[model samples]
Target chain A: MKLPAKAAQPNSENLPFFEGAEKGDLVLPRCDDCDFVIWFPREICPECGSQKVSWFKASGKGSIYSSTVTRRIPGGWSKVTPFVLAYVELDEGPRVMTNIVECDPEHVSIGDRVEAVFEEATNRDGESGPPLLRFRVTES
Target chain B: MSIKGKAFIAGVYEHPERHLPDRTLPQIHADVALGALADAGLSTSDVDAYYSAGDAPGFGVLSMVDYLGLNCHYVNDTETGGSSYLVHAQHAAAAIAAGHIDVALITLAGKPRTGGDAPGGSGRAGGAPEAPFESQWGMSVPGGYALAAQRHMYEFGTTSEQLAEVKVAASTHAQHNPHAFLQDVVTVDEVLESPMISDPLHRLDCCVITDGGGAMVIVSESVANRLTRHAIPILGTGSFVKSSQSGRIDLSHTGAVRSGPLAFAEAGVTPNDIDYVSVYDSFTITVLITLEDLGFCERGTGGQFVASGALRAPHGELPFNTDGGGLCNNHPANRGGMTKVIEAVRQLRNEAHTEVQVPDCELAVAHGTGGSLATRSASSTMVLGRSL
Candidate 1:
């Protein structure tokens, strides 16, 4: 799917996060000093300020912490209308912002179980880029 | 030592014309700053310190100082989002009390509509950077606040209609305000029927976008005593800033949870003693969250408290945002806090237009929230009392 060029480019600090998504794994940084799972992949642990951080695959399972239906889409957001943007609290104890696909925006509710899913990302000009992660409501 | 009652607001002014499409940003800053000094019965020559946002019009505080042609010994240009000016007041009070300075001027001016640089949104760098991962999801301003609204509903059974009550009350006040951008009386039904920006927040839930500026002159109690105009005492102040780090945010509460009590304790009053409130209303949820966090009601009872219409009309148990607030009134870019301060000053002095005036307003709370909910945020609250 088409994504903004900003969405396609991963900064140096978060490169490993995108690299894992390409391999179909939801990897998050885990702090060795504090056992804190850091999302958005920082070099140092926010909880304990330790440099001893490593990437590990997450359970790929989470529940909707909170959500909103974006009826007003700003420029560069892939022209998706009435999509569900949500914060998913993963089983690994970190929350990530992702879009909920495969269902109507109004149908998604807080505390609903979801699973991480990755899709091929394309630049604004339709060039291939890193894989983007999203979430889908799991079947009951 | 506490800074309580050490500083007083001598003068305040909100530019009468909020939408200045043709004026330059520096011009807005100059106009409001000078206008406020005039209101205080003082000139720039009497000011010893200047306080403003570093990112304000004309670039940083020095540029504004240069543009305004003011020579000051001290300057503070802290940028804490929309609440920056309120925080500046807090800092100014302490500085004055400590004998660091005698007179302080806090200014906020931006051209959100005319200058092509609106204040709210996520794309800025510095301070708290956007999560590289979350930026890809394409979140809007309303969407960020919507997450908090959604969570509040999930946890406390808050209803959309209840949120609508906030808009309705603000509109009721706006109807009596001539300077308000929106004056047509709006009902809860009308708010619910308005176009939705996010799920629970409608177009009416959000503040109007207008380009304007406001200024305040804060002086030491000694200087206040000499001034001709009545001095509004700065009784208490509190502020808190939170980064967008995960696991630290309780969406149900906000930084106001910490700042509110500190201000109240300093002011020697509780929420029950407040005669009027000027809590920020960037969105309906902004007001609800602040009301709960500032001890207006129990944490989960904001929906019921607001729905009672206790915040509306001539007999509101606790009159709030009586000057139309940011919702239907003028929102000068992101400097919504200064207007909140001005409203409190007016209510305390019994200078508010007759319709929205709260009789014998003795204590007023002016609170502001900036950045986004569901992300890193900043909050500042101030308690102002009429000098006895």
Candidate 2:
């Protein structure tokens, strides 16, 4: 998917998560000491402050923890007005920021069942990058 | 050690014009500073320390000092976004108590409407230092607050009408203040009918963008004793920084719950004792959530609490945001905390305009929320009174 030009470039802490997205997999960091899955991919576990962490792929299905229909589009997002921006909680734990697509933005709500899907988007510069993770209602 | 009631805001002034296309940022700052000094019955020579955030026009303290010709021993630019000024107030009070400086001047100015580049938006940039995952999905400032409003409705059955009530109340108060940016009274229906910026948040549900600024002068108790003007006491102050992007926040509650109590505890007062309030209303949801977190009502009941027009001015149960709040009055371009503090000082001193003044308002609470709603917000709460 061609991400927006302003889309945050992945770094050492979150490079693996982006790589997972590019490969059509949902990867996350887990602290080995406390077995806690961390979102936003941090080098150290916030729970135990343990540097001993590893990355793992997980089941993509999860429920919508919270969702919003954003109408204000800045720069690159002008194409997708009134899109469903949601925090999807994975079955393995930890909520991720992804769009709830393939459904009416207004129809999406908290506690709705959703699953991740990957799509390619190109920026205005015609630069195609990683496959962005998006979610869709599963119960429907 | 608590730094409560040791310092006083002896002087306060705000730029008269809400939108000054002709004036630059530093010009606004200098105007307000001189006005506040006059209000305090002092001259520039009396100020020993200075505090500000961000930049004025294109310069910082060094240029401002040279331009304003201020001679000072202590200076700080502790920028914490909108709530930085409130935190500056807290820090200044402590510094005075510690004998670091005698007279402290804190100021804020911006030309958001005329300067083209107004200050506001999400909490912080996405990635690296913040939650990369959240920022990567393209979350805007209102988008984050929308999530909280959504959760509130789901959990408490809060309706859009309840949120609209907040805007109506602010607008009603603004109608009484001539300097307010939007003084026309708006009904709940009108608020609900406004265009949607984000889910569950309409245009009126959000704060207006305007160009304005305010300034304050704080002095040690000893310095205040000799001043002729009413020196509003800094009864108590509290601050908390909670990042919402990375941490697992409930989204329903915020740092206000922790910070509000700290201010109240140090002030030796309860919510019921507060006669007036000045809370940052970056959005309608901001006010509702803050009222609940501040212990004015039980969690999840904020919607109902504000529904009865209890927060409206000119005779509401609680005269909140008497300056019309950010919703109707002004947001001072980028920073909002300074305006809230200014209003609380006005209310406590019985100096507020006759229309919005709270009768015998001896105690007031001024609160500000900075950053984004998704990631934890930085909440600052202060309790001010007429006398110790």
Q: What is each model's TM-score for chain A?
A: 0.88, 0.85
Model 1 residue B379 CA deviation (Å) reads: 0.9
User: What lDDT tens digits, residue by residue, belong to model 2 across residues B178-246?
Assistant: 888999999989988888878889888888877878889999989999999999988889899876534
- Model 2 spans with C-alpha error above 4 angstroms: A1-7, A74-76, A121-125, B55-59, B118-128
Task: Quote the positional error of residue B107 for candidate 1 in Å.
Answer: 1.3
Q: What interface RMSD does each of the candidate structures achieve?
A: 2.2, 2.3
Q: After superposition, how far is residue A117 of candidate 1 from its true place, in Å?
A: 1.4
Candidate 1 contains a number of clashing pairs equal to: 0
Clashing pairs in 1: none
List the TM-score for candidate 1's chain B. 0.96
Worst 10 residues of 2 chain B by lDDT: B119-128
The CA lDDT at B208 in model 2 is: 80
